[model samples]
Structures are given as C-alpha cells and as structure tokens.
Target: MTRFRAAPVLRALVTLAVLGSVAACGTGTDAVVQGGTFDFVTPGGKTEIFYDPPSERGTIGNISGPDLMVDGKTTSLSDFAGQPVVVNLWGQWCGPCRGEADDLETVYENTKDLGVAFLGINVKDPQQDKAQDFVTDNNVSYPSVYDPAMRTLTALGGKFPTSVIPSTLVLDREHRVAAVFLKALLAEDLQPVVERVAREQ
Candidate 1:
C-alpha cells in the first residue's frame, strides 16, 4: 500500500477557504435575535439521500459519464463494462475524500492485477483545476469521469440529495452494483470487499 500525502498548495487553499467561511459570520455589532434559533432551509426541502450506511448496498442501472482525465487519456464508464469495477465518487474540497484517496489508489494498484478496474467520478466543485491537481499530486492511476454538471450523479438518482463525499460503489462483472460504501474508506477496511469482488469475476 502507498502512503499518500496532501500537497502543500492544496492544504493552503483549504485553510484559506475555511478561514473565509468563518470570517463571514456576523460580528458582535450585528443585530442578534433573542432566544430564537436560526432555521436553515434547503432549496428543495429535505434531500433524500439514496445511500444508506447501515445497508451497505445499493443498485444503480448502467451509469455513464464524460471523460475527465486518467493516465492522460479520456475514458468513460462504458469502457469498463464487462469487467468488475470499483467506482469512487469524490471531490477535491472534501476532507473525507482526501482521506480516502490513498485507500482507493491502493485498491486500484492491488486489484488491477486481478482484473478489477477502478473508476473515479469527480463531483461538481468551484475549483476544477485544484481537483485535477489533487489527482495528479496523489499519482492516482485510474480513470476519472468529470461531473461538473453532475450528469452521471443525476442519472443515478442522486440529484436534490445532499450527497456526501467519498462514496464508493462496487459493480460486478456484469455492471450491476454489488455494494455501496457510503463513507470514507480505509485500505484495511476495503481489502475484504475488493477480494470478494475480484474473486467473483
């Protein structure tokens, strides 16, 4: 397994973003309501997330997306059809996503020899360049599809839901989802699942 580290530039950018968000809060001079809690409303009411952590299972139809970049080539989900694949949904701005990157990369490295293909789906974010840089910096050697418009996510019935970062779906050789990991993955935590899927092929 490879040990992954975040680039200094990415760390700085994340720190700045956090600071900016914190600085935007109201100051002492601002008018404060008495004894009333602030209520936050989502644009479309409460989002129904498709992923359930307890079940650890989800089935999605054949989902596809446009090529982003991987190993310097453009590719799509359809290319891996007929092969068992581990699809990871992630974003550069997400802390959990960063934590799971190395685990995913390790899975890719270990399972490729066993005929398992790893695919990445990048979610929409304000910083596309930084997202690409994150992939490059980590030396991720798997294909990643761009989801700037979240087309693939929408196709998977994930729109209007506050989808968390670092969700992963495992598809069997026939392209049917076998399992869904709804949280950040660690290399040790994923080994059994990887082995099971790889052996199924």
Candidate 2:
C-alpha cells in the first residue's frame, strides 16, 4: 500500500490560505502591508485598533494601569502621567525584538528630551542574563520590568495586550490608549505617532 503523504502538504496549503485571507482584508496590521491603521491582535489573534492619531478614534476603556517592578522599585503608569508614554513588550530570544531594539532606543533618546516615558516589559524570558545583556548591548535606557511569568502583563487586565511578542502601546498625554502596534516597530514608524500624542492637550 502506498503511504499517504498528502496530509502534510494539504495542511500547509490550508495554513497559507488562511494567512492570505487575513492579508486580503487590506487593513495593514500585517507589518508586511505597512500602516493603514494600528493593529491590536486580540483574543483570537484578530486585528483591532482601539485608537488612532491626532484624535481619539475609538472608545476609551477604564484602565487603572498596572504597577510593574523594575530594579527592586515599584513603578506604576501613574508615575509617568502628564506626558506621553510608550510601553513595549519584548524578550531576549525574539528575533524581531533584537531588530527593533535599536529603533526603540533611538526614538527613546530623542523623545526623552521631549519628556516621553518609555517602559519595557520583558516577558516570558527564560534567560534573564541574556535579557539584561540585550538591554546593555543595545543601550536601552528605558526601565524594564522582568516578567518571566508575565505577571505584570496579566495584571494589566485587558489594558495592554501581551500576546504579541514585540507589541507596543502608545499612550497620549492623558494616559489613554493612543495606538497599539502589534508588530516589530521602527524609530521612523513610532516618531510621528509619539509626537502626535505629545502635542495633544
């Protein structure tokens, strides 16, 4: 009897077909397509945008924000109020994280001068040493909470989505969700978004 080897090939085709269907939506959350809008891949990994630039585009949620521990100090979002804040979730082994590290640092350096707060959530990192080294090597000046179990992430409730490895959440000066980028980010991709929020009253 000839062995049935079509199953694997069929499964591969189906996977590709599903990805194509999502891409065909043309919403541009898929980094490959570039920004038509901000993408917050939620519960089912479906794309959603909670906010946009220049003005609030969607409903604002009641988020008390989370208090994450960094370097033995208790820190909360409230501590960064009165200015735009950027929260980035990343890990050591994530390839995209490495690629975007410099971009994040560059933007942070420039925007910090403008009083923007950048916080990093190091999630699911198996190797804390490697994670710290990554920050040191990349010259990441932002303070990051070590979240091997993602406690800080989960504690945020639905305020922040930690499902995306290199996700970024941009908050306006009012501390409301301004934009959520569910992909690896670049300095150029974030500068305008941050500046827009900073300019808001």
- Most lDDT-accurate candidate: 2
Error of 1 at 165 (Å): 1.2
Error of 1 at 58 (Å): 7.8
What's the TM for model 2?
Answer: 0.66
* Model 2 per-residue lDDT tens digits across residues 5-31: 887778899999999998787432111
- Clashing pairs for model 2 are none
Best by TM-score: 2
Clash totals in order: 0, 0
Cα-based lDDT for every prediction: 0.64, 0.67
> Which runs of model 2 end up more than 4 angstroms from their true locations?
1-71, 155-161
Taking the tens digit of each residue's C-alpha lDDT, what string does model 1 give over 64-96? Answer: 544555333445556776778887888888898
Clashing pairs for model 1 are none
